[model samples]
Target: MTDAAIAPRRPWAYAIFLVVFGAAGWWAAFQLTLDKFLVLEKGKNAVLNCNISPFVQCGTNLQSWQGSAFGFPNPILGLGGFAAVIAVGVTLLAGARLARWYWWLFNLGVAGALVFTIWLIVQSAFVLGTLCPWCGLVYLVMFPLFWVVTLRNAATGEFGSRLTRIGGILLPYAAPIAIVCLIAVGLIFQLRLDVLHHLAA
Candidate 1:
């Protein structure tokens, strides 16, 4: 009813959202890590010996260098990053007062993760020519988690009021730019589908 009453509740709402999303991300990351390890340990034998179907075959993706993204396994990054996010979420949910500097640092980490996910999506579509379902889940969860957390930080004035003003101004333009980029990337993959199939053959 009153501004003062509503003001106190907003942080709790954001904390709940963050904790739920962070937990989901952690679960997805854990499952993906297990899949990656299974594939690595068993190699080609993993497919037949482990009862993995073609659709769920981690080996299919893991056998390729793209599975690593970097020189090492990608799920390792997910494990560590999501674990940190989980810790932050739990701390906030427990009513811990995070300093402005800490919120800024967390925002930066989430921003970097969102950017990395975009790159992974591009690689999966064009370069890898395949997608892991579990990895897709992580991408879907992380995208909105990043947006919500950043918005929460802005709303709370953790970064400064000016950032919120900037977000309001840019959201309209940013949405369309993101849509167009996604469509363009999808078209590139569609156009290359024939070439990819031929190479596979």
Candidate 2:
């Protein structure tokens, strides 16, 4: 039996996290979007404050082709998407139970976000070879958001009873899963870059 099954159902728990992280994610995305625009307008002459150090830089990712995969800065999408999350969170906090279809749609959106974040993480660590501080913050917020949504869907039977049972069973594993993902991300960076040198610099 999963902790979720035996543990008391606290709907507010997820709602509260949704509100907190949703707001935070939006704030980070908004800042990144603005900085991206500023960088584009000024070009090479722009001395981005986010360019704190060689390894701890945002410009490298901003200037990369992947940054504008859809011909506009990715942060623009982040701004919009994170805003949607905030709105949904607000609704959830209001004691509104979203519809099954809405839950399905929300899960789809979060799944896309998960995939998108992973792609950007890879691009930053391997391709671009730089990490955007704001983007990193968004990635950190996304994991639990995605996990909670998935578990909620299962609990509520959006994916059927069997999946709901599985979701409850999976609840205890969420933190471990997230930790493994972070470990993998760190490993990728350590393998691809001179981590000790970059840290010392």
| lDDT of model 2, residue 188 | 74
Q: Write the per-residue lDDT of candidate 1 for residues 1-201, one digit (tens) a residue.
A: 986676433356556766777777777677777767777787666643222333323455666777777898777777788778878877876767888999899989989988887887677666666545566567656766676677667766787888877665554454355456545654654475443344345
Q: What's the CA RMSD of model 1 in angstroms?
A: 5.1
Off by over 4 Å in 2: 1-10
Tens digits of per-residue lDDT for model 2, 98-145: 778998998999899989899999899888887777887887888878
lDDT of 2: 0.81
TM-scores vs. true structure, each candidate: 0.73, 0.88
Taken over the whole model, the C-alpha lDDT of each candidate is 0.67, 0.81
Instruction: Give residue 15's error in model 2 in angstroms.
Output: 0.7
Question: Number of the top candidate by TM-score?
Answer: 2
Candidate 1 lDDT (Cα, 0 to 1): 0.67
